[model samples]
Target: MGNVLGLESFYRRQLRQLLGIRHPRRISNAALYKRCNARPLRYRITKARWVLFGQVPRGSDRNPAFMQMARYFDSSTEGGW
Candidate 1:
């Protein structure tokens, strides 16, 4: 959770800097995202995670690494990453 918040904070700061937005000017995150035509960092991260996970199932069953991933996925508890 701390890492997620840190990444989001860094992302917002970089975007604000890129657009020359400074302390004096107040901007909502939604507005900032609209201006940049970008999604939130969390959404992007979630999408990337799903994409990677999707690839795991497509991997060859004969590969030891893929088999390990399969076992991990099957054994992992709910609410895990």
Candidate 2:
């Protein structure tokens, strides 16, 4: 399973739990790489090899490989960086 910046893995954990980032021991890997404030795909997620965690957002035209299929129904899906 791989999509890189295009998001997969359950919508990248639902866009990193809508930015609060919760998973992998309730949140770890250096606290989701410092709450992803620097973004560079969260320091490339420990050099990605079938990721242990995920997220990718930096400006959005809603096409990060189809943007989670346009958020199913778009009842206010979420935000970004």
Clashes in each model (backbone N, CA, C under 3 Å)?
Answer: 0, 0
Model 1 Cα lDDT, one tens digit per residue, 43-64: 8888999997788778889878
Name the lDDT of candidate 2.
Answer: 0.50
Candidate lDDT values, in order = 0.85, 0.50
Residue lDDT tens for model 2, 1-81 = 255455434445655677765545376434554676434453465568234223333335475634653564467756622
Candidate 1 wrongly placed segments (more than 4 Å): 62-65, 72-81
**CA error at residue 9 for candidate 2, angstroms:** 24
- Highest lDDT: give the candidate number: 1
How much does candidate 1 score in TM-score? 0.73
